[model samples]
Target: MKEGPDIAQLGALIGDPARANMLTALMAGGALTASKLAAEAGVTVQTASSHLKKLESADLLIQRKQGRHRYFALADDDVGALLETMMGLAARRGLTRTRTGPKDPALRKARVCYNHLAGELGVALYDGLLASAMLDEVDGEPVLTEAGRERMMQFGIDLAALETQRRPLCRSCLDWSARRTHLAGSLGQTLLSRFESLGWARREAASRVVHFTERGETELLATFCRQDQNSHGNRSQRIMRDT
Candidate 1:
């Protein structure tokens, strides 16, 4: 009689090759039809139905109806974060699939983790913010500093409106590809959207890959790199005044 959580059962559900593949596809932060999931798993629709049933019953997935088709996605941000952490653990342990594709490098460079940017560029963004003291840690959680708010506002992000949303303003997510921590939460999502709107980057069609144009990459680098943070003396001056 186990009184604790049933981790073994959850492991069994996610350990299957087909189910794991299907779940990975949903990491792109899009709802996918059962048929599409089946294709991703390379299994028959009937088999996919059985797998999806187990996942849904365990509350690992949620269903959505669009038009005449039913789509499935990860239950929430927690689930996505868990999966990403697991992937990072696997990579750290040298347990990875041998068959790699052309898009692998691109994905490692920049991709969407659930809904926010992740990978090398994502890690860079997180690093830049921290190096610039734009974010501070409070009770182990990341908090947006006053300087961060100013910078974000100057970049055209509506902080006042975004703060009104129910979602958190800042969170740290583990980036599996880069094996580092990247930003997540309402703020992270908005920043990625801002990049797209500014034509700095674009998510690839039907894939998690994010492609930054040459100019966009250069701009992103200039913005997030620590060397460039020196130009922003206001933030440092303000911090000095407070300290």
Candidate 2:
């Protein structure tokens, strides 16, 4: 007899059209009420509640209570990653849904992946960090370099505080749209927060799209691209001296 984790069960749960819609709606990285999700799924509130319960039972969704209201969100980043990978595969195979919304272009440019950024901007950030030696590949995962730590601190990211968290400091997640890697894990989330705090970008309501002002994009490119050029040159000089 074969023995392994049951992928079939999970697939079945996600395969239902209504449930899929509900799950996709939660991908925006916000906890939503059942009524809101029901509208997204085009289902009745009672039906949405039942579907939510099933997802919660399957450990795909988590329930949060605030005051007198209950909201739902993706259980964790793993679930979000899996869904994004699936979407990427389907898109590549030409299995896209018939209708594309006006927000499609914006979504492909910059959108949220669970909490961190995903899309063209996301891939650019990952490449920038790698090219700059701010992040290094270690055992197939991203590890913050000494230079990365110092740079992040300069940007007001509290690396000391981040180290205290249970989650990993850095990770690389595959980008569905760009077919590249994007930063994930706690550090990724913190960076997104920093962008918002700086008034450089904001998440659109009812969507995963991250809208960056013209000034914001300019500042972002200035910060990251310059790091790439400077860090690479500095590292090369260090290597020459050591040799």
**CA lDDT scores, all candidates in order:** 0.85, 0.85
Q: What is the TM-score of each candidate against the true structure?
A: 0.89, 0.91
- Cα lDDT tens digits, model 2, 1-243, are 778999989999999999999999988899999999999999999999999999999999999999999999999988988888888888889888999889988888889998998887777777778777788998999999999898899999999998999888998888878776788999999998899899999999889999988887777656763553465445423322331
Candidate 2 TM-score over all chains jointly: 0.91
**Which ten contiguous residues of candidate 1 have the minimum total lDDT?**
234-243
- What is the clash tally of candidate 2? 0
Runs in model 2 with CA error above 4 Å?
227-243
**Model 1 Cα lDDT, one tens digit per residue, 101-152:** 8999888888999889998788777777877788877886779999888988
Q: What is the lDDT of residue 201 in candidate 1?
A: 98
Give the C-alpha miss distance for residue 18 in model 1, angstroms: 1.3
